[model samples]
Each structure stands twice: as C-alpha cells, then as structure tokens.
Target chain A: MAKQFDQRKETEYSSRDLETGCVITDPGNAARYKTGDWRSQRPTWNTLRCIKCGLCSLYCPEGCIAPNAEGYYEADLYYCKGCGICSRECWTQAITMIEEEE
Target chain B: MMTGKRIGMESSLGIAEAVKLANADVVAAYPITPQTHIVERLAELVANGELDAAYIPVESEHSAMSACLGSAATGARTFTATAGQGLELMHEVLYVASSMRLPIVMAVANRALSSPLNVWGDHSDVMAVRDTGWIQMFAENGQQVFDLTLCAFRIAEDPEVLFPVMVHLDGFHLSHVVEPFYLMEQDVVDKFLPRFRFPLALDPDKPLTAGAFFPPGVYGEARRAQDDALRSVRPVISRTWREFEEISGRSYKPVETYRADDARVLLLTMGSFSETAMLAIDQLRERGQQVGLVRIRLWRPFPFTEFRQAVGNAETLVVLDRAISYGGPTGPVCAEVKAALYSEPKRPRIVSYVGGLGGRDILVSEFVEMIEKGTALAESGVEEELLTIGVRV
Candidate 1:
C-alpha cells in the first residue's frame, strides 16, 4: 500500500507562503510525471516466444515491468523511459526494442 | 526525575554520558583535541556495549559530518563533535545539515582559531560559524554541559523545530576541568526526550527524496523558509527549556542576569567566564560600585528582548569578548550587542573590550578594572570603539 502524507494542525504546507522545506504530498508522485516521453527507443514484448523467466522484471532499472492477470510481465509505459534494459536482460528473446516515434 | 548517581567527573565525559543516555542512534566524529575527549568516551561507550549506536570513525572532519548527514537523513538520532580547524573544515556541511532540517546535535569544544598554533579555549571558532543557521547555545559549567547536551536533542527533534543544534563548551576549560554535576537517570532522560521520529524519513515503504536541488525560481523561497523556521524555533527552545527545568529543577535562560537589578555599570560575558565575572561583580559591589553581570547563553537567534531587559538602568555596558572580529570590530559579541540595542530608545553606551584570547585567563581583578575603564570611556563620550585588554604595551 502507498503511504499517505502525514498532515497535522501545526503544519501548513502553503504553496504561496512557504515556511518549510520541499515536501511531496502524493506517494510515488514521480510516476505522475511520465518519463516515457524521454525515451528514444521503446521495448516491445514478444509474448508469443513464451518464456516468463522474469529476468526482464529483475533487471528493469525503473521497476516498470510487472505481471499482468495472465501471469506474464509487461512494461508500465507511464514510467518505462524506454531504456530497453528488459529487452537486453531477457535470457529468452521474449522482448525486443523498437525505435520510438517522435 | 534526577535519579542518576552524582559523580565528580571531567566535563567532556559528562557530555558523552548525556549522549549515551539520550540513546543517540549514530555518532560520526573525527578526533580533534578539546573535542577528542567527547568522541573518545563515546567510542568507549559503543565498544563496551554501553551504547547501542553506530560509531563511525571517519578519516576527516569533512567526511565525519558528511556521514552524520547521511545518518540523520535515515531518520536516526545522529551526533558529532569537532573543534577549531575541524569545525572550519566541516563548515560547508553545517549549512546542508541545517537547510535540510536534519535534527542532528553537535557539541563544539569552543577553541581559538590557529595562526600561532594555539589550542586553548576561545569563542573564535564558534563565532566564525555564527550565521550558518544552526541553533547555537553555550554551556557555562559541567552541569549545564550534561543538561544542555540532552536538551539539544529535544529542541532539535521537536516537530515544530527540526533544525540542527550545536551545544558549545569552552575548550580545555570546560572540556577538561573536573567538576561535580548531577546526572539524570536513563528513565528520566527517556521521559524528557521521547524516541526519535523524523517526519520525513528514507523508508522503503514511503519513499521520498530529501535534500533535493532547488532551481533559481524556487531557491529564494526555500531560503526564506529556512530563515522563518530558524526564527520560529525561539519559542520551541523556551518550551523545551521549561519542560527540562520541570524535570531537573535547574533553570536556564538565553540572556541570564546576575545582580543587574539596580546598577549603573554592567559587564557582559558568555560561556564559563560568566561565573568568574559574577565574583568580580560582587567585589565591585563591595566597594560601593553599582555593577552587575549579563551573560549571553544563547548565541544564534540572538536573544534581543531578554538582553535589553538584563541591561536595564545600566549607563555603561562592558562587552567582553574572547574572540576578535579581525579588522571589522573590537569583538564580535560587542558588535552584536551594540546592534541588538541600537533600536532601543533608552540604551547604554557599549564599551568593546577584547580579552581572554587563546585560553589566557581573565583575572577577577581585571574584571573590576574593565568596569572602571568602560564606565570612564562611556562617561567621557569617547568614540574609541575598540580596545585590546591584557596585550603587552
């Protein structure tokens, strides 16, 4: 479960009148600002190859890959910065990288 | 609440005992004399299993403070001690600690700065870092050393004020001198200081970035916030002190007065010298001289209101400083005191006198002479702003 921001009566996180340091209210808010737009190459999973060894999930730098209802791991596009680490880490050729369109 | 055994002990050891009793989670320090005794005893405590804290003996003062920053960011109760050049070396990290609002407590064995390689006691080191945004306080005796060390944790960790605090003791004078002081029981310390709980911690379940870089657009706001936070901690400091007083029955104030009720001349001092100056004030009073003592215990967030009240009805205020401001002013304390009272409608003429540099003792007799000279200077309306006392002519 994601942790919630601990707000108290004493603390007033004013955007206009700041009296405290930088604080992020939403947990995992980094995902909100999608980094997929920064990608030059995108990973395309070849599910037909039929190998769920989970190496792609293990080696993913952004932790964007997770198992779907079918029990096969897929990339979370919102944060997948398209780093192709999963494609490179896959022991079986179950994933491939393709050029991201501008 | 004061249940611990009373023992005559070296002041530095008393400080170490307080840190141990506070149950500090991390202690990172590099050895520097006057300050060495504190970390040395702390190391012994950790090694002997007396303290359950991680003791990091880093290679340099810079890395020591850097380690403390990391430890504090991890939501641990962190501490470190350094002196003179060591403090100067860690000067940059000091700002990072305060700006990040890491509640790390540091004990600075106040010592004279080096050019002549002197290692004696002076306020030059502490004065050098006066504006680094850390909450600063001076301990006048062994008892204050123990109590204030413990109090620094409470003041720094309070949710209302999470800024780091530095508790200073005069080097060799307070650090090495053996004095009898009361030690509160561990249970009492626990009652006074609750378990450390940082609002922002580096927990895996609740990950959030800390000490992030601020762009030019938002940088000014961040700095202004830090300033506001420092100013806001004043009441928290008083509240923390008052609570501790209830537990220990030992009172403290930022601007403490001694015999200044009905006086024409007052001598201002700080740290351990205030006690010595009290005796001098007694001597002056015996000879029918109306004199008193005003000691500044809190350095930063400089207590302006209490200081003005302490110097009430006095015609001349003799400001004694152990550190010089080089070419700027006679003494930093004198310069600050003058600035604090500059706006008041009724204020005494400030006589700037610099003495007791590099651990040289300021005799009791010299205190009387300083009062006379200062009163004379104030009366004659001389514009001389600086005087170096005890320097060979």
Candidate 2:
C-alpha cells in the first residue's frame, strides 16, 4: 500500500518526521517540482516558418513541449531544461535557441 | 513448545530448510566457497516443487545483491548467501539495501579474505562489513544458525524496523558440520512469522519514488534517519526472539553468559569458537578457577547495554578475535569491546588475543592457556597490546 506524502516542507521535517527510507510517497510528484530554473538556454518557436509537425514536442527531453490553442507547438518553460534539442531537430527551422534572460 | 522431529543435517541444509519455512519469495545468489552449499540446496528446493520460490542464479555477488534489492523493493521477501571475497564484491550494494530499507535477509558463511587463498572460516569478512548498516548476528552452532536464520526474516520484515539482516556462520566450521536440531513445524513457523507487507512498495498503480536523489541539503537528514532507525531495532530483535521462543522451545539472547554468575574472570568469544571456549570454561571451573564464558550473538548496533551487564563484574576479560586488524592496536572486535567499556565507571581489564585465522584451529587447551595468560597479564599490569594465540614460533 502506498502512503500519502505529508504536506510539509522538506527542510521543516526532522529525522523522525521524514518518510521511512526517504521514500516520496506521492506518486508523480516530480510534476510539482519546477526544473525550469536550471535552464541556461531557452527555446523560441518561429511562427512564420512553423509547420506543426509536432516533432518538437516528440523530441523534447523533458516532454515539456505541447500544442498551444492556435495549433502551434510551444515549450512549457515551467518544466523545460532547454537543452536545445528541439531547435537542433526542427524539421522546418521553426525553433531557435537563445540564452536565458536574467 | 512445539518441536518437530529431530534429524541430523548439515548446517547449510538447515539454513535452506529455514528459508523454505519462511517461504522466501526470491533468492538471488552466486556460489562462493563455504557459502555455495546454502544456495545449491536452495536451488534444488526451487527446482523441485518444495520451495515454490524464484531462485535467481546471478552472474556474480554484485548482481546477486543487486537483484535482491530489486526483489525486496517490490515488497517480496528476499534472501541471499555469500562469503569472504563474495561479500567484498557486493560491498557497495550493501549500503543501498540498508539505506533503502529493504528487508533482505542474507546468510554469510564467514571466511577469511583471500591473499593466501584460504577458503576457511574466520571473522575477517564479518569484521570488514561491520559498518555496512545491516543488523548482524553470529551463530555458534548449527542449531543457532538455523534458529537465527528463521528469526532474521521476522526481524527484518518488521514494519517498524525495515532494515536488512545478516545471519553470519563460520565457513566450513558451522556451515559444513552436521548436527541434529529440533526443526519447528511449518504451521508453528507460519503462526510465528507474519506475512510481510512493505507499506511503500513499488507499484505501477501507486508509483512512489524510492531511493530518490538526495542533494546536500537533505542528505545529512536522510543518513540521520537511517542511523536512528538502525539503533532503534534492538527491541524488535529481542521481541522477535521472544515470540519465536514462545512457539519453539529454543531461546536466544543478545549476550549469552554461561556459568558467569559470580565468576572473577570471563572469556569472551563470538561465532563457532564460542562453543569451544565454553568447554575451556568448564575445564577451568572444574579446576577451581573462577572463570566463565560470554558469547556475543548480536554484532551490529553492538548490544552495548547487554554486553556491559554481561562483563561488568569480571576483573579480567580475555577477548578472542578470529581476525587481525593489520598494524592496528588490536583485533577489530577487541578494539570495539574496549571502546564500549571505556566510559563505564567499573569496567573489566580486557586482554586482546587474535587467533584462529584462515580456518586454523584453536584447541581447547589453547583457549584455557590464553585465558590463564590473559588473567596473568591483567594481574601483573603488563600492557601487551595484542597477543596472537596458537601460532608456532
């Protein structure tokens, strides 16, 4: 049986209060943890030359790219590591890699 | 107390029988000398319809322990057997099994490390893994090995104490020796050991991440939690032993003493040699020498309280170690014993001796002689740091 993760900050929990074996009881909890802060580069899509072949979404290492409401694909900056794989593999040169802004 | 029919069997086979009784779910092991017979017999049981368990014959000891880790993480009762070099091969994975809190029971046929290429019984392997974080227990005889192996499953699988356990028996000494011991009935064993249920097991429907990456921020806290969990398992070990005793007539203790009530001097030993020391103690007692014997059954978490109480009153304690520390102050076990008694207000004068290495025999006369020499050394206040017994000069 899976146990529920206690709703407390990791630093706030003492040794005794932590889960046994440091097991993260909440399944799929990684979605809640943001990794976009680790990005050194950002991916920008070019709408003019865009062919919504969805290859960018398919090749995302983090699987963080998806289609926007206008039927064009975009990278979800919240979870993306911005490895530039989408820009490197774009079929129609529709994506560009740019340095992440401060 | 319900006891099954008494039968003569090799200690390794008895261990296999104990695993069968415990109904272990998976046994992943590679054959290593002195420890081969255990897995061989287990493989045979699985080959037939007797065990009904998955016997994974791994490529090496490293994979053996790694496979056990996967099996145990899935909430399966797992077991494995290894020896000197084999134990060292799986050294790194031992930490993972304890840190992840998987209740894997391992049988170690204690053997001396290789260099001289000896496949004999010694505590060199056991001493090497002393800090690996698994609860360790040494068995003095075939009966104790069988009993402790059975108890290991119950102790490790306890939800409150979800750490691995190592049941150590001397290679070729206890593992190869054939002895008759009362085997508990299957129904009695079933009643004694509850079905294991790991609360946070890996399930596809309920996916919880185990052994997640702990950065520097939380790594210290995780280690502290593991340390506290290990130190707190002594009570569960005792309670499991007690519950096992209630069903079967066999009783066990952390630190067992023999004829030590009012003895002035005591001899301490572990593993199979403790039995021989007992005979030496009896001989000394018959000759009007007030001597006794103390055997340390529990090694990890170091049974500090029980050990202190067992050796507190003795004026001199002769500690017999089977492995050398190689240029250190004394044998590994002796150093620990001295450290354990250091803070006590009234502690015994400890004389350390390292012998019986690489499967060499330490005779009863030698034990008697060592005790007398230790007593003499303590009485004379001559501080000889380390003494090697039974060596031809």
Which prediction has the highest TM-score against the true structure?
Answer: 2
* DockQ score for model 2: 0.62
- Model 2: residues >4 Å from true position, as ranges? A1-8, A37-59, A65-102, B380-385
- In Å, residue B152's CA in model 1 sits off its true spot by 0.6
Q: What is every candidate's alpha-carbon RMSD to the true fold?
A: 6.5, 2.9
Evaluated on chain B only, candidate 1 has a TM-score of: 0.98
For this target, which candidate reaches the highest DockQ against the unseen true structure? 2
True-contact fraction per candidate equals: 0.23, 0.81
Model 2 chain B, poorest ten-residue lDDT window? B212-221
Model 2 C-alpha lDDT per residue in residues B1-393, reported as the tens digit of each score: 648788999999999999999999899999999999999999999999899899998899999999999999999999999999999999999999999999999999999998989999999999989999999999988888999999999999898899999999999999999988789888888987868789768889877788887666568888999999999999999999998888887889999999998999999999999989999999999999999999999999789999999999999999999998888978999999999999999999989999999999999999999999999999998877779999875
For candidate 2, lDDT tens digit of each residue in A1-102?
223234544566666666888888776766766689789999998999998999999989899999999999998889988899999999899998899873
